[model samples]
Target: QENRITTVQCLSGTGSLRVGGEFLARHYHQRTIYLPQPTWGNHPKVFGLAGLSVKTYRYYAPATRGLDFQGLLEDLGSAPLGSVVLLHACAH
Candidate 1:
């Protein structure tokens, strides 16, 4: 079997976001990027500079000290088709 995935290399975290953001800005039809609220502080600036509009979805809920799954679903469910979503790496 042949690998079908194509990956671009870049430094981790901020660097990766920057590169990915730039790529999306150049090629993706939708320019809006939705990130989880309370995500890494650098996310907005990174995607903003890459020319995408940054929007936030609910994530952490302090009352339970955990993810607010309902709110997250509500937010994502309303996103326009083809909008880029920024999520944390599984291990992060």
Candidate 2:
């Protein structure tokens, strides 16, 4: 059995996100992508332009000035099976 993986070097974050979005748009069964509520400003535009439906999952809580952990879990749990989620690992 042969499993093939192809990798492309991306020059920047936005570019990488766009490429990833495009790949998912073509190969993923679920077309909707879940982004964090308080994500980078250009995230929606970049993913949307790459042909994926953009949706938000709870992330930051402005009132508390911290992560909405429970809200995030609930939002993600409610997402359709196989939906793509973009997680920001560090500060954007």
Candidate 3:
């Protein structure tokens, strides 16, 4: 087979997210980051370390083990304008 080239750099998801958040916080003003409920164990810490205030929105439902669509909508509706909402890549 012909040779193929690929690049791989191993970095923790939490670390990457935190770094991104920090950049945003430094560059943006009045920006808020919303994290889903029951998100990654370190999500809150990651964003907080970035100097951004992290808020929570309904995401998971204990009974259904799925997303709470209505709850999410309600939270979004309540969020102030220019807020940054984070959603899981493959929540569905």
The most accurate candidate by lDDT is 2
Better of 1 and 3 by TM-score: 1
Candidate 3 vs. true structure, TM-score:
0.81
Would you estimate the TM-scores of all the predictions? 0.88, 0.90, 0.81
Better of 1 and 2 by TM-score: 2
Alpha carbon lDDT of residue 43, candidate 1? Answer: 90
Q: Model 1, which residues run further than 4 Å from truth?
A: 1-4, 90-92
lDDT of 3 by residue, 1-92 (tens): 78989554437887668767877889987557998887887888888878889899998888998889899999999999888888898784
C-alpha lDDT (0 to 100) for residue 46 of candidate 1:
97
Best model number under TM-score: 2
lDDT, model 3: 0.83
Q: Give the Cα RMSD of candidate 2.
A: 1.5
Better of 1 and 3 by lDDT: 1
Task: Sort all candidates by TM-score, best to worst.
Answer: 2, 1, 3
Q: What is the C-alpha lDDT of each candidate?
A: 0.89, 0.91, 0.83
Candidate 2 error regions (>4 Å) = none
